[model samples]
Target: MTASTLMIQGTSSGAGKTTLVTALCRILSDEGYKVAPFKSQNMSSYSYVGEKFEISRAQAIQAIAARTEITPMINPILLKPLGNYNSHVFVKGISYGKMHAQDYYKKFALYKGLTESKNSLDHLLQTNDIVILEGAGSPAEINLQQYDIANMKMAEYCKAPVILVTDIDKGGSFASIVGTLTLLEKRHQKFIKGFVINKFRGDVTILYPSYSVLKKKTGKPVFGTIPLIDFDIPDEDSLHSNPKQISWSTKYLNVLDKEINHLSKIVEKNLDMKKIRGLLH
Candidate 1:
């Protein structure tokens, strides 16, 4: 069988998608799976060492999680979009020079070559049991949605299952998760196996109500609510640096539980609480 892929995405930017993907890479690796990580396109200033070509720092982090060396093929297209519609594209981690948005669109055929390159690399790395794919920013941005070579489009290309991840700290995370589920085309939504609520604070008991509501609203399983981890992971987005700023507090747990219970009364439920408990453990 071919390696399975899980695409981690979020409702908006700075939703901790990258960090969670990296963590999952680490978790799966610990389980003795030969894992690899891939991102169709990444926009970051950080760089990583590669045997034949350079790789994105984000992929490098995942590589570290997998205890493997960085490979350029893991991140095929690296777009550094400065102001304007122009961005620098990297093919196989080597600078392919720059192109304006219009120029790039005009030459969209070139992306197929990059995609093929990634497929060839995946074939060569047949030792991997799983390949975790990371999606770009919110897949809901309609303006850029069609031109999207990442996220859902990338999943379609690679034929991978998707795991939509949203940040609960963002207040409207429920809406964002539901909106993303509803807005995606049928094909894309079919590939989505479950949803994860990230950056959760307070007690899990308190969060269960909202989780149940979201599950009922979207008809998707709540894979887990990743509590705010204090690891010093680098921030890929231009957001707050300290994750510790929004962790569970003893005083707030009771109120949070009450709120969740109240919400649960109004919405339906369909989450595997046992699986969620396993994730926490």
Candidate 2:
């Protein structure tokens, strides 16, 4: 039987999609469910080689959260951008050589990347009790929607229930969330299970009134509001990282175990886990 899927999509890049997915993987694992983390395509300079295949370091980190071994299936397509519109693409952890952006989208992604991703996801669905999917960037990128295997298209392929997350640290969180939904076709919109407001600092009660207003507008509930974290978490993408922050020990994999557990506890306390689990089919 296929496992249940819960997809984490962001209002935009750096919106905490990876953080939520990582936390949930640990949470589910602690609950004694066999879980796996998956991202169809990841564009990152951070890479990890596990089981003799290279994949995005983010998925590898989430696999640790899940207490599972890393595999290429967890992140099948990795694109390390080279200069001048070209990216070094890796398919199933094997180098596919460098290709221009246009060719990657028009030829590789449209013709082959989606199929490869589906196959990997199918394997995980069959093997795990549940799979946590993390999406890249916003699903509402209209110009790239046609070749988007990382967001709505992937969610549709797996019939995964989506939880849209946004960073409250960024102003206009509500607008970004609502606008994202507004831009998507209704068919894609239906897959979203709810929204999560991340990196919040003030009293959560102060946000309650807004949640109701959001529900009134989008017909979706605010599933959670996560507080801004104090510690440094080596997240999937570095776009949002503080450039001046000191970095050191995360290089050693064991160092993240404590942080992962800490993250899980915080998310479990703040998030409506029962409702989130209910989203699984």
Candidate 3:
């Protein structure tokens, strides 16, 4: 049986996309589904597995979610740009070495062979369950939109349904979600099964009206508004990398407060204070 895949994309980066995908992978695996995570092309300096295996640290975290060993096939064709249009390409976790964007595009067909190889690797791993694919930044980049093997095109390739995620904490989340849906090609919209509003704070009741409007506008189901969680997962995006250095804006401070309060209640009931205090310090 072919493996069913789902692409979790965001309005933009740092929209809690990686966290949601990891949580879903864990939840599904707990429900007895054999799952794997895939990313078409990842461009991050904070990588795991080094120059040997070109996958992102985020994909490695997904491997952990699946309770499986990390493999390069899960994230093939990683590009680490070192200024200019030049970048170092890693194929299956090993450095295939560096090339400029124009040069790479000119020889782009060669990467298709790599993608096919990765697909073959995925086929070997599929034991009749699911594979969750995470997409790169906004699928709206008009310039790079055509060469989007990371988000929409990857979903089309794998025949996976897409679940677009937008961060409400970003203020224009409703517009971002609706606009993304509207901007997608008619064919791509068909694969967009649902949309999610993430990192919501305060009463979810208050957000229902906004959510309703978005649903009506896009004609897509709102999966659920995911409350912001305080759990410390590794940062995959630079935006959230330096938590200590970056003070939360007033808006996000409220989001953090709500998340902290929620977690405190849970910890008060289930966790030992002394043990938790040690980790906190």
Candidate 4:
């Protein structure tokens, strides 16, 4: 099957992009599509080792959801921030050495990192039926757009339709969506086919009015609002002790496992699966 790509970019970090990608992967996989989760560049300390290289824990969860094997190519560029404004750069799962912020931006982006990322993406597209690309941070960061390989730039490179996600629980959900659209160039904005408001609690009826205005303002459909789930999943970045450390061997994890399974059903029902299928085309 030919791979169609959809890139999930959030209004901000921790806006449920990872979870949505996981759910979308599972939904697509369950529907009989061979899917893979991709992130061109990821900055995370909590990671896992694969057969060939290391990848973020979030990517591993997404691969599980998609029922696909994990590969270093799924996350070609990894920047693990090591305190004191330095990060360890990994290109295609191998260490490229530690670098200061300025040096990394100047030396790597133009020289080799971007090329490696594009190659990895091309490989995934060739192999998968659908590629669910999860963008790092907000794509609307105009200052970083020129150097960005993980957000809109990656979406543009892959020719993927994008779904902008924002956290309603953080408040200013409307502002986040509109602000992101307003900040983006028209071409980049055009890539955003839909919007997703995540972590919304209470009746959705109250958001009807706002949703209407948002659609009118951005000329994009609100895909669906995802309610907050209490279960702990592997977060990309959090101050709390790593969820990756918790072994599934514990009795408590057995109950958590069932809840996580139930979560996929919730995701399938709440999201507009039909629309999602249409968008991929």
Which 10 successive residues of model 2 have the least lDDT summed? 240-249
Q: Which scores greater on TM-score, model 1 or model 2?
A: 2
Q: Scored by CA lDDT, what does every candidate get?
A: 0.67, 0.89, 0.69, 0.83
The stretch of ten residues in a row with the least summed lDDT in candidate 1 is 262-271
Superior by lDDT: candidate 2 or candidate 3 = 2
- Give the C-alpha lDDT of model 1: 0.67
Tens digits of per-residue lDDT for model 2 on 60-82?
88998999978888998999878
lDDT of 4 by residue, 235-280 (tens): 7775345444644345754554455566777877777878878879
Model 4 misplaced stretches (Cα beyond 4 Å): 238-244, 247-260
| Candidate 2 segments exceeding 4 Å error | 238-251
The digit string of per-residue lDDT tens for model 1 on 1-281 reads 57766677778888867776676666666668787878877776556645567656677767666666577767877776675988777777787887788877557524663465457446624657777788888888887777677687767766776778788887888888888888888878887777877777788788778777877777778777676655544467446443222223555534433433333222112234344223321
Clashing pairs in 3: 52-93, 52-94, 53-93, 54-93
Ranking by lDDT: 2, 4, 3, 1
The TM-scores of all predictions, comma-separated, are 0.79, 0.95, 0.80, 0.93
Q: Cα lDDT of model 2 overall?
A: 0.89
Prediction-by-prediction clash tally: 0, 0, 4, 0
